[model samples]
Target: MVYALTTRITLSTYESFFRIVRQILPLNYNQLTIITDYERGLMNAVRIVFPQTKLQGCWFHFCQSVIRYCKRSMNSLFQLFQTSVEAATVLRMVLALPHLPAESQINCNFTMLDGFQIIVDYVNQQPVIRERLQAFLFGYIQDFWFRQITAENISVFGLEFLKNDINRLLLYKL
Candidate 1:
């Protein structure tokens, strides 16, 4: 069985958690996995103590970097990317693209279903912003691609951007 948890805290908090877990749980080599937010110091500690555990930076946090680089005004394009590839067919399309041009790569990576959730979750808490965002995403998709169900499109916001070219929005039916 696989288990995952996202905890926000200082390095010391994670250090303490590991220390306590080590003492209480009879942990074995390569039995634990740590998906962290890439705090180098904390990762160092984990490495020193649990050498066999696999540690990876959280994908959710990595997406934030993409969002930061992406244009704020082009958010609607991001939504189309998300809705288009949230499922099996679209996901396969996303997985297949590795060497696409830079602009299209951004669209391909940023529009991932998994990514949209994290971005929109943060956006949704603001006053009236969620509705406005919903409107924008819907309008963008309808105007370009065929109309799609909102729920299905939004579910895969956790997948990483394999391709980054978003400018390709001009070339296809989407």
Candidate 2:
């Protein structure tokens, strides 16, 4: 349910979104699905304030992001493989994500975990995106995205246990 709406869009503004939502609902959303556009500021704020919620990227926005990411993450591939048609193919895959049942989503999450090595390689090769995002998306992919699906292998990913503790504390007031 929509709780509040305001024009101010900042980290603090997003915190208020969570605050108003919780005050209205009074529910423990240890498991919840949050579909959002490519608002990284709000996304990070949500991650900080609601550690348990599973954040999913909107398919439309994700398609836009593919274009954005392609522009930002260009290499030899962009002239050929990064055309709009190719991006549509990728968008189609992302569009399929929401249709999958919960069990399939979990499996896809695990599959994403396996593909993270590709992300690591990409980051290593393309430092510009890392610097541009200020490590936000990179850190999100490394630390939060699909980690719960691979909780058993978290140690291999070498998460910041201290940061997780801090997230739990931040979650309490939200």
Candidate 3:
């Protein structure tokens, strides 16, 4: 049931969202999975209104946002490699997060310390990137990845397959 159509064209405010949600019938929180982009306002409202609902953000949007931010400052960091390979590698590492499971402790501990090193090494030598990376990438994404790739979470990331593919691709390139 449509509780309330948009009465006017405007950006959503917490009050507006709250009003719409309260009008809707009681929801089954057990089956409610809300997938959204990184909108804290809306997310906060949902948490307050429906505390038990599972609300996860869109992985693609999160990664794309990170990727765009990195691209703007990448030139300062990736002077060691040709642009083509460098861009591909940078994006591969960023995009790989979504494909990985939320936790990897139950499965093999294919942790992401290597990936962390790659990221740190790429940015460490460049002053501008190092500064911006600490600000943009460290707080949220770093903590999130560490939690997911820790020694206790179940792993859905395909380690063997990725290794084989990487080997084949490198062989072809070399």
Candidate 4:
């Protein structure tokens, strides 16, 4: 629940947000939840401070990252899914899987599901991309949307979706 001071949103400005959140909410709070726009600086700072927090960037922000890293055609398909309930439903199911072969992970920009082996393979295969994706998933994916309602119309991504998204991107099947 933070915004930039000016028009341009930089990491420094974003980091200030955690300070603001801390000032308002006590550090003794163990069950803290953070929702942010996935600005790298803010994300990094949050990690340093709240290592175990349930951090979730909005679905919009998650989609942006997917579009940024995925291929043009894959992005287009995702866009279509975004607009259609049926597609998104199929996508939601397909994206909920948490395991894939090593080669498939690379084609989809190094995203993978949550498992010690899957994460390790992904990281070993592509260190830089794996780091970014892992940061995004952290606590965010681990406890995703236990209370989610279909009317909410936003997908809470976790390692499960990461695995599924990669498969779809690689096969162009879903």
Candidate 5:
């Protein structure tokens, strides 16, 4: 656990803070997994300071961001998510992507790709909606979730223990 009161939030400030953390903690960078929000500066700082450490984004934050985006930019989709059970289910499934198995299991080889494929398959079922809302939502998912934040950073995949702990923390906070 670490805490610092900072007046400025920037890449250099985060780098300095992380450097201090590195100096104080006897961290095994390879084994360390830091869960954070999708703050670009902080994430970049961590990468620069501890290149080998695994950086995971908070799942709650990811969900919150998606919902917020829908509310602000895609109000029609947001309304559908609230009123339509099928749309709600789809939204839930998208949010649950991070909770799905990151790697191949012994009995079932269900991976993130499989989860995404399921969504794509479902979306493709409706040709009319697929052209408009599906395109927008999938594009947002692909660009922001996949290309920008990345599946590796947002998904719980290989960090079950961390996921459980994070859930507990989230529950406690809520």
Candidate 6:
């Protein structure tokens, strides 16, 4: 299942690779869940080739990417994240978002409100400086995570048990 490619990783390259994989493997695409890092080209190719398969971004990669982004784009905030316990906690909460129940609904009368309101509410209670930090974090989450990668793909809630069961089944089969 590993490919050592000399060519640059691109949509065409991934598409060609996936096409060959489809030809070679007797895979049940419907039952397949591919967990990969957030690479748009590879993800898009997988979606194109195996539309029925579930695609999930690796949680570790997601966290690393977010932290790296914070460090690069908002260094002051990143510094605060490292030095301040409160700031660290908020960032940790943001990172833990993928563990939230994906199916939970928050009843809100306001058009702008959603499940993330809880995070906002917590941020609002913090000092004004922290509020600025919250704004940056929220904007980042909204623009990058929510827009580019879907919440469903990011969230791992309720999947741990299924993953465990799958692991058990694989062990038994082996």
The TM-score leader among the candidates is 5
- Considering only N, C-alpha and C atoms within 3 Å, which residue pairs clash in candidate 6? none
TM-score of 2: 0.44
Candidate 4 — which residues are off by over 4 angstroms? Answer: 1-5, 67-174
Write candidate 1's Cα lDDT for 1-174 as tens digits. 223253755566666666766787776748666554445566666777677886544333333422332225455534544564332232233322222221224445543343434444555565434554564434543232112322222222334441232323223232
Descending-TM-score candidate ranking: 5, 6, 3, 2, 4, 1
Model 4: colliding residue pairs: none
Order of models, best lDDT first: 5, 6, 3, 2, 4, 1
Better of 4 and 6 by TM-score: 6
The global C-alpha lDDT for each of the candidates, from Candidate 1 onward, is 0.43, 0.47, 0.51, 0.45, 0.76, 0.71
Q: Count of backbone clashes for each model?
A: 18, 0, 7, 0, 0, 0
- Model 2: lDDT equals 0.47
Query: Of the pair 2 and 5, which is ahead by TM-score?
Result: 5
Q: Across residues 1-174, which tens digit of lDDT does each residue of candidate 3 receive?
A: 333354543335654765566676566767776554455565666667666776565544555555545545543423322344544455566556544544444763444555555666776766644564564446535665454323122122543334433454345421
The TM-score of candidate 4 is: 0.38
Candidate 2, residue 151: CA error in Å? 14
lDDT of 6 at 119: 64
Q: Provide TM-scores for the models.
A: 0.34, 0.44, 0.54, 0.38, 0.81, 0.79
Cα lDDT tens digits, model 2, 110-137, are: 4443344444554455543334332333
In candidate 3, how many Å is residue 154 off? 15
